[model samples]
Target: MTNVKLLLSAHRRFNDLLSALALSADIQPFLAKVIAAVEEFLPDSKVTILILNQETNTLHSGAKNNLPDFYNEAIEGVEIGASIGSCGAAAYLNKTVIVENINSHPNWHSLLPLTQKANLHSCWAVPICNSSNDVIGTFAIYHHQPKTPTAVEHEIVNVAALITSVAIEKRELEEKLRFNASHDELTGLFNRAYLNNVGDSFISLCIRNNLNCSILFLDLNKFKRVNDVFGHKRGDKLLCQIANIIQQQTRSSDIAVRFGGDEFIIIMENSNDLDGEKVARRIHQLILESVSNEILALDFGVSIGVAMLNNKPQSLSQLISRADQAMYIAKRSNLGIYCKP
Candidate 1:
């Protein structure tokens, strides 16, 4: 093909690949297709995509084409630094990194053995950034022979990186929206909507596995009085404190939900009524101590009701209703109590 024709063909392929990536719901398959497209455009090069993990400050392999498994393993989770390999440095600097001769480059000193084993001699990487210009990943093309990327090859890498950034940002925003929909804004606990949506499935799972599960329903005592006297700000703070205490008292398997107003629910998997009561008591004790010590001796307490799955053997709504009724009983008694249903 003529040079102009080749350029036109590459642009068409790039557009087609970007369209496919944009419509993909999952990142893995999108990345796989991206690397494949890169390999097709640069037949002599191996393409790999690495995504930045902010929590670990490392680059993780997202996709690879024409690369050995051992080479991929060697570069996985590589910490980003000034002296790290092309992808790591590009991600850290938020810019393109071109290493024409990997064998002689100081940046690839640590990765030289792996690259030599894989017969890779050159690497060019472009940093992938989101709309906010935050670098999220790297798109790298490695050559078996020592050579710098041609102008057209550089254009292709840059466009691929841009496409990747758009896809990642879109996915992240979708995840954030989903999280906000199901979580309480104040206490960061699962909201009532989330609890209602999953409660039935959780109950069915417990029943099918013949496992014991319990629900602890909690209601803050005289919470309106606190808001009236202490202002809504203080009341909000107190609720947050209570939520933290409940979370601390519950196990990792428990699903804690802020079930509207001053009410909360905890679904304890593989737990009996006794276990639910223990958690309730611990939460009450912690709240009493926290409110007394931190909030100027304010009168804050919770009335808890415990219900076991085996005891109820009914719908989740019935269990919650029984627990709610039990909570009212505890509230009327004016005692630090956990009633069973």
Candidate 2:
């Protein structure tokens, strides 16, 4: 196909992808679409999108097909550097990288065997950057023959990278907004909003599956004094520490929430009343120890209440009400942990 015609065709596909992005809830489908578009425009080529993981400083395969499984697995978590193959080098330099002959390119020296096994001979890649100019991923094309990218191929790569960047930024922004809506900004724990949304449905699932569950309602004993003595900043720090402890103690199936100021709730799945009390005591003791060790001048304690799901079907609100009552009783009676009858 002529370069002008190919460019026009790719532009139309790019526009279609942008429109689809408006309806895309996740970034994966959009990324797949971008890859498909590139493969469609450039026949006998395989494309892969590698997303950068900021925390790990590594590149992960976000979308790819038609590549050999062994080749994909071999480079699954490849690190980005100046000479780590076409995709890695493109991501590291934040620029376009083209290797006309993979067998002779220094960047592909280490991966040459794998590429040969996969019948890949040439590669070209461009970094996909967000609006802030931060490199988020790379758009790469591989060929079975040792061939350089033509003008048309360059246009296709540019269009695909631009479309992918927009899709990723949109998906990430949506995820952040959704998280803020359901999470406590101060503690980064699930908030009352999330609990209100999922509580009844979760309880119903527990009942239908015949799984035991319990609620642990916790209230800080002297949180007000801490805020009055030390500042709100210190109080926030303490709260974060407590939230971390709660998250660490609970299983992945458990739901831990910062219900409100100085109050927290933990929904334990597959746990009975006795196990609930045990977990409550453990958390209480850990918080006590944390405060005593971290801040020697201040005295802090936590009162926890445990409520178990009985044979009678009940809503999450009912379980929480029972646990709240038990917590107040514990606070009033100076009992560190209490279970509602």
- The candidate that wins on lDDT is 2
Query: What TM-score quantifies how close candidate 2 is to the native fold?
Result: 0.87
User: Tens digit of lDDT per residue, candidate 2, span 1-341?
Assistant: 77898899899989988998898787777787788888989999999888999888689988756688898899899999999999899999999999999999999998877988899999999998999999999989999999988787888898888888888888889988999999999888899999999988888998999988889999998788888888899999999999999999998778899998999999988645488888898899888888854353554678898898888999899999999999999999989899997
lDDT of 1 by residue, 238-301 (tens): 8898888888887776789999899999988754548877777888777777785434444556
- Residue pairs with colliding backbones in model 1 are none
Model 1 TM-score is 0.87
**How high is each candidate's TM-score?**
0.87, 0.87
lDDT of 2 at 130: 97
> Each prediction's Cα lDDT score?
0.82, 0.89
Query: Which whole-number lDDT from 0 to 100 does residue 249 have in model 2?
Result: 94
| Model 1 residue 302 lDDT score | 79
